[model samples]
Target: MPLLFLRRCGWLGLLACLLTACGSHQKAPPAFTASGYVADRGAMRLWRKDDVAQQTVNIVSVYSPYKGENTVITRYQFIRDDVRQINRTQNGEHPETLQIRFDDKGNPSFMQRQRDGLREKLSDDELALYQFEARRLLDVSQSLRAGQVILMQGRWRNGVMTTCDGNEVDPDFDRRSASWVAARTQRSTGQLGVAWLEAPEGTQLLLVANEDFCHWQPKKSEL
Candidate 1:
């Protein structure tokens, strides 16, 4: 009877070990990742989505100027590391939009630009610049990801902020910045949201507004 009891205990221990091993290996790589950096005159947030089955990558970048009301959003789509399409939209006093599609050989297959209610073709030089910028941003994103620089957004209520992923966090902001955020939150009639970037260097506040940033933010399906 004692031998049977010991055998039962051994089987239970082996089952527990197997379950733990399975759980450890069950974690899958995330389908999407986000990173960003502070530009010279503003902050730029980057969101990237990877489609492993399609061998495609999509990156959307939003650049908000510190002093101007202008906001620029650029989306780049790549197939197997080659640029496939680029779309950019700028909103402000002088709004403009650009769309470019490249062929499999990396040649522009379609291009269009609209400004001030006028449609125009991109000059060769402008097209080249856009292509260059797309590649440069991809390189920058790779470096940012490697450095673990990340962008996070959340809703601010009272003094607590609930992250988009449903986690509560106390962002590392300067006293003045915190006060400014609180003031804005208090003045806003709608839900106030905040965005920040985290890096090994430090944390930096990106934006504070009444809009629901996560609602319109790019998702894996949209990418």
Candidate 2:
């Protein structure tokens, strides 16, 4: 009896060791791609409604402050690949929105919005969407104009970054209602909206960022 019990304990320890090793081998997610578009450049044009007036604005790009200020009225695009989309709307105004699309294999497809539509941004060989969006944002913010394409580059310290500030928590955790309620406390905060585009069989998901717009840490359900 003693010998049998000792053998069982040894087997259990080996199983635990194997499980832990497998868990450690799990891979982390790829870093986000970023780029900025030049809104003032001659090649690209900002979308303006016919009813809007055509004023002679400054040649320099104007960026809306993340806090305590009105909209900067610049045109910038923030895009992730096949993972999410973040659209902004405020006081009846429709701000720019981001979109992401994925391929059948569950890998992301680099796509871009052209002629007011989305097309693959990168070929299968070149998969770099985050870098493209980051650069586009920087260019637009740096030299914003009425008619130009600008994209911005940002990093996700924990989860992701959106145009709005003060909302840093990951906007992806919808199941945690308690956390969502706490995030709304900061009325001035802006959260990121996520949409997964699985092309041909695409799935659209909307993720709301926390009040800080920096971290994407989802709270525990019980908490």
Candidate 3:
């Protein structure tokens, strides 16, 4: 089992540290391939509207605070590969009023307004779907985030000055219901309201922080 230690060296997990994923060359920063969560509250632009369904958010995860809900408002086209990764996991029902909240212990649970028979803790395939949708919204938030969320993977070596902060890797994130992520894409009515509708399913994003912290932590259910 990996012991999560609260250290001043930031959130360099013991696994990554043991693997020595850290670097300090001063010039060539690592190009991380990871997903950022829009679980936090933020604003997003209407990047592209899905004239077909009229509701759907493509990506998420940003450094700065935002003013909008989960809506794509820009047409930037940055993270190509990250979009592909998110696309691979985008084959599921788009939630209308779904909200994912965490318990006191940092375990994950969910509640959607219109869904029936759904529980706070999901299981097996149910859990998978919840994660898929959660991650999808998070990725959409990442794409729309104005800038990159700081991320670095490596050992806290000696004399290696880095601007990387482990804000994403915090294991204790989403500890309360208020910190839970909630998103509801506005579905278009036929060809009308296209401006507020979600973008195409596979459109590329403009900017995304390669932070991997929000990827696997906050397990789906409490043990």
Report the C-alpha lDDT of model 3 over 1-223, residue by residue, as the tens digit.
1111111112233223322322222343122222232223432222222212422323332222243233321111122212211211111243223344444342454333323333333355754564555444443433322222222221111212122333222122122311221111122121110001111111111122222323432221210
Q: Is candidate 1 or candidate 2 better by lDDT?
A: 1
TM-score of each: 0.79, 0.17, 0.22
The residue-by-residue lDDT of candidate 1 on 1-223, one tens digit each, is: 1111212324344233333333334344366878765565776789988788999889999988877778899999988888899999999999999999999998999999999879998888988899888887776665555545578988888678888888999988777778889789778876787888775446767778766777777776777
Worst ten-residue run, lDDT, model 2? 195-204
Positional deviation of residue 183's Cα in model 2 after best superposition, in angstroms: 58
Worst lDDT 10-window in candidate 3: 190-199
Best by TM-score: 1
Query: What does the lDDT come to for candidate 1?
Result: 0.75
Q: Which wins on TM-score, candidate 1 or candidate 3?
A: 1
Give one digit per residue, the lDDT tens place, for model 2 in 192-223. Answer: 33211111111212222232322432112211
